[model samples]
Target: MEPQSSLPDDLLRAAPKVLLHDHLDGGLRPATIVELAAEIGHPLPETDADALATWFAEAADSGSLERYLETFAHTVGVMQTASAVTRVARECVEDLAADGVVYAEIRYAPELHVESGLELEDVVAAVQQGFEEGMAAAGGRIVVRHLLTAMRQAANAREIADLAIAWRDRGVVGFDIAGPEAGYPPTRFLDAFEYLQRENFHFTIHAGEGFGLPSIWEAVQWCGADRLGHGVRIVDDIKVDEAGVAQLGRLASYVRDKRIPLEMCPSSNIQTGAAPSISEHPIKLLASLRFRVTVNTDNRLMSRTSLSKEFALLSEAFGYGWAEMEWLTVNAMKSAFIPYDERFRLITQTIKPWYAERMSG
Candidate 1:
């Protein structure tokens, strides 16, 4: 166990982690956004890099999903062309790598990036190229897989699923549904999920963030998601007593028993008002209850965080130790959409070895 205030800088740098729920457009570098917007001649809310960063952080703190989502218009406004998509994807990989991420599944809806009249497949291809270039530049083994998201409020979910299946072996590893959570229930995309199921493609659903257990239940029972994105409100399904003990509701019990991974994004949860604050985030509670909780950065730019920053905050708020961090790392790797053999290899060869060396040294 390592104390947060006393955590060695070396340990922070050496921690090997996996990220599974980051959004591609949501994590762009402020400097890159400025440069990209300049190239595209898209007007941004603020031109100054630091000021623009502040704008995103402030706007995302509005505590409403609609406002939080509205911030993406600028990011996507510049990402309509293939070159921008490629560069963003590449820079995203490099940024994650610098934070010691070994693997990441970066997600974005291809439909939104096609405002330039490029087809969906071209969007995927451009991102794939960027990921490859970034991985090569990282000088360490950092693997990135694209999770093709279909905006839940949109009408082209089935088409997106088809595209996901089409690119299954070409760096698109999974499918996802991301958009306003209130009105667009998972049921709206049941056809897409069913199509993905038939194709044997892996997918995750955005649920239980602004909504509650019913959304999570629908994602699991109805949509058949392999993982949950920002499943923070699944906390509503648990009953805690005065003695600090807990009882699991049926859905909670089932999710635990079934080992469905909850992609818990602590900082983003706080910013989005999904959780009251980081100190009260359900991540600690869910981890204590062994609910397959994994740490993530849902939106780096908006939340003003990276994976290391997310871990640092959790460690500070909860007094997390190395074992808890290791558990989270393993949980993320295990819950990754990659094949079982690749996940196991990462656990055995990379995660374990890296942590073991750090502990010993």
Candidate 2:
């Protein structure tokens, strides 16, 4: 018998999901943004929540990564104060929990939140506090962790890396660098990556999305990234012939051989021009080749998606069944920056049993 038949929207939403590439600032609720913006007197392009949401989706649909990222100014503008940051963080967890996310690593740049004179540590503390409150509200249904990101174009990666290490024991699980990838290569943050390595910390770099193979190469071979954020562009090194055979170049071979996780956000990738569309996305080929591919909602508000919505879209595009869904979910859990035992427990205890029941039923 087949592992499963069709994936209904309800089943997809009920599946236990693990997310690794969500952005804290990028996933705010529409109403939250309007409320916070009004309280802070931050001017917005659209005053109504529905109109603001539409504006974000429309503006982020620009085909350039830089232009797509320009939408963050509004989200980040409303998140300057501590209470605003905490409320956004808490709501993020609540939203993910409602969407059936069992675990998630929400990333944001602390340096960006310091525009209102909040210290880096203070920003981190506020986020952690909100996470704790959200988790408490979740009642053990979902677990959330922070991945402190340093803007790749900035000069404070080392500082952010140190901040991640200091909070490593608390709630911050890893580190990352995110920004326009064309001008700022991962090597520019070599000191931070190297420091994280020396300190025995984990990190994932945003590469192979806005830029191509060189950025991915430097992130993996040079910076020792634990994962590749939005790594859909690794397909650049993969050549396919008319006979339907694919040849992997040195970088692609290395990425596959080492089992580096690729956090692919299908809808968000289409928005940022990483992939032309979901049907033609590299994720189809990469996952077929078993390249440790994992699905994610890079930015819920921008992409107008959730973990469930991403899976639903993939199911429609790729004819994915419960088996494929389970594989992708397991891939994410396995690639999480959390400890091996924790990952194993969640995979074996939580993720596996649910999929097994669904398949058997």
Among these predictions, the greatest TM-score belongs to 2
Q: Please give the lDDT score for candidate 1.
A: 0.90
TM-score of each model, in listed order: 0.97, 0.98
* Whole-model lDDT values for every prediction: 0.90, 0.93
Global fold similarity of model 2 (TM-score): 0.98
Candidate 2 pairs with clashing backbones: none
lDDT of 1 by residue, 1-361 (tens): 5345444555765588899999998999888889989987999989999999999999999888888999999998889888999999999998888888999999999999988898999899999999999999997679999999999788999999999999999898999999988888999889889989998889999999989888999999999999999999888888899999899999999999999999999988887889888888989899999999999999999999988888888888888767778889999999998899999999999998877775677
Q: List candidate 2 stretches off by more than 4 Å.
A: 1-5
RMSD of each: 1.7, 2.1
In the range 1-361, model 2's lDDT, one tens digit per residue, is 3232378878777899999999999999999999999998999999999999999999999998998899999999989899999999999999999888999999999999989999999999999999999999999989999999999888999999999999999999999999999999999989889989999999999999988899999999999999999888899899999998999999999999999999999999999998998889999999998999999999999989999999888888888988999999999999999999999999999999999999999
